[model samples]
Target: MTAQLEATQVASTQLDKNTIRRRIAWRVAQEMNDGDIVNLGIGLPTLVANEVDKDVELLLQAENGLLGIDSLALEQQIDLDLVNAGGQHIIAIEGACYFNSADSFAIIRGGHVDATVLGALQVDKYGNLANWIIPGKMVPGMGGAMDLVVGAKRVIVAMEHTVKGKPKLLQKCTLPLTATGQVDLIITEIGVFNITQQGMELTELAPEFSIEEVQMATEADLIISPHLITMPTPH
Candidate 1:
């Protein structure tokens, strides 16, 4: 490659540190409607709460009991009582309330959640997910992932393009399965993909990044949607 092309490529990738994650969150939020109750999975999924528009009355629900809240910036000190499903310290919004874990599961299992955003370890062409384990290791148990994936009306997954620089979205999952073909969407740093019957279809691509570039970033054979669009730039 010529030095000029290299420079252009480098400059294009020089996006805001949290731009990709926030973009994923923003897009996911766009799928939600007013008064829609949401359940955010641990990790990147939880961060979605912070990226939503303030005016959007998107109610936030937690499997660990809290509901109708927003994300709070972490402070030096922590509050043991107020935490996320991941057990991270958090602050409660004004009208936030809590309930029993069993009741929370019931809400999820009963399809009370309008939408759920979750992080995944692997997602196949057919939308199968493997987010609960790392093969041969069972230390971290599957919390409410199973319930949320199957119960929610829509399941959106937020994750990096790869793990340890390896593609997690594959033609077939090798990791212990979390839920079989339950994902509706997969948002990565490079693009937004949707799981279809044929394969993982690219719905949106990052700025200046082509569908070919995104395909190169993954080991999976990513198929671009016929109506693929470019992700909107942040203001």
Candidate 2:
């Protein structure tokens, strides 16, 4: 291919990736309810903070003992001490409070948190999550994920449809499990899956992708939702 064509392909790929991430974040944000206390895990899940509607009364929780997080914009000066679980600088909203890790874990493990958005390495059809370890690959140990997953009323996963062209949505998670059968919902670049007693249901799809494409990319069988619809994309 010509240099111009190669450049175009690279730009297109980047744009696609960005669009996918934004869509996943937006969908996860829509799941938030007014006055809900939510914890957002590191990585892709953190992006949901930006997509949340300003009017929504969500109290963002950080595992490191901060609550009611208000993410700062690019131009804002970040306070070194005010960081989320991902260690990204953030601002505290009105009524925000802080405590020690003991209190934080109490809030999480005691089931006070309404919801938690997390990113996963692999999620099986049975809603099993394997996010902490990737076999031989070195990774930060699973922090409060296990506690949060079991404690939160709702567990939503936000991640890419695939990793390095390999499917992350699988028949069975090959990686070590973080929390077994705990995922309530999953938002990926190509679609949304709702985990029910029956199994993973494909409830929504990206406009640019087809059901066949999604099925092909997914390793597990997907139950098509009767009310399947196109996913909302960024304008």
Candidate 3:
């Protein structure tokens, strides 16, 4: 690369919010295993779909009853009647199926969902999650988060390292609980963590951040992994 082009790239660095979110989504996409039946929560988690490995065969299900989701539909290809759990337009693959809310929840609550990716307001050392509601604020009622966390075989929290510089990974959640002792893993712009019987483990660090920086951004105690890896930035 020429010096001028390198300078242009540096000057065009994405705003932190966009950078972190895209990084989290891309990292989460890599965590999916072939043949897994995955449920994606709204917002950042939905972004994971487009980043999934093309060769990986996994079904994406939305709580709103659509399954075998192919991708988020382009504006031109959108069907008026189809959408994901977040009400965002999406494309359903050939074998896609739709059902009533009853059957949808049945698929999740029946323990058929292999994994669920969700965003959280807070995650604690004990694998507890709080993402539903904040005190003294009017908001949409907690959707299916509680059920998803409880019912899915694996719960993954895909969120930024912090909320506007405030640590969202805490020693204990300060907000209303979505589920307790449920989250299996967390992916953020700064690192990847796993909730283990011993506690939260920092298994990987982003190439741009130091271990000290990660700890400073987290309120939960971290058990550093023996085989820590550097997380590559998404192109």
Candidate 4:
């Protein structure tokens, strides 16, 4: 809450898209467990695949009806028929299986998913999420977000700290709700937060920024953790 923490408050202009996205991805990947069944939502969430630890293996599922996703295909490896929920070319790892939406939703609804990473437009202190649409703008229609949040054992949100200097993490979500009290963790370029019964708690922050910087970017009141850690991003 005070500006004397150590570093200056984060300015929206100080962040770049690629750096912020990758840093968010790196932090989120560290949360996945070995052999976990995971779903990475479209857009920013998909970048998480590039950051998973090499020693930890995970099963990737695309809501578009594919499982065992290996990685985003290289230019030469592209298969016209294969893509993730985001519609990007991907390679299916060996033993990967494909099915229709019914089977895919069944996997999600059946509680087979271990964790799901998604991007949010707004997330509040109560763990409420709203990312599907923005008021009057034509938005990407809600796909499997509602099901994943309700079905996955854990739900993590990957996103930027702010949008053009506007706070996205707020006292309450201004957009349509995706689900209520379902988010477990949220990773942004500036800090990592845990949605709790008390409110949002700052667990970790980028080493370059101070707690003051994070507080300025976020609209909701942040509960400073007793054991906060500094998270350094890979260059």
TM-score of each: 0.87, 0.92, 0.92, 0.94
> Tens-digit lDDT track for model 1 on 27-82?
77666688999998888777778777778888899888888767854786467678
List residue ranges in candidate 3 displaced over 4 A. Answer: 1-15
| Model 1 residue 30 distance off true place after TM-score fit, in angstroms | 2.8
Task: Pick the winner on TM-score between candidates 2 and 4.
Answer: 4
Off by over 4 Å in 2: 1-15, 73-75
Better candidate by lDDT, 2 or 3? 3
Best-to-worst order by TM-score is 4, 3, 2, 1
Give me the displacement of residue 37 in model 4, in angstroms.
Answer: 0.2
Selected candidate, larger lDDT, 1 vs 4? 4
Q: Write the per-residue lDDT of candidate 4 for residues 62-134, one digit (tens) a residue.
A: 9989888887889999999999988899888889999998999999999999999999999999999998998
Residue 70, model 1: lDDT of 75
lDDT of each: 0.78, 0.85, 0.87, 0.87
* Per-candidate clashes, comma-separated: 1, 0, 0, 0
Q: Clashing residue pairs in candidate 1, if any?
A: 128-181
Candidate 3 collision pairs: none
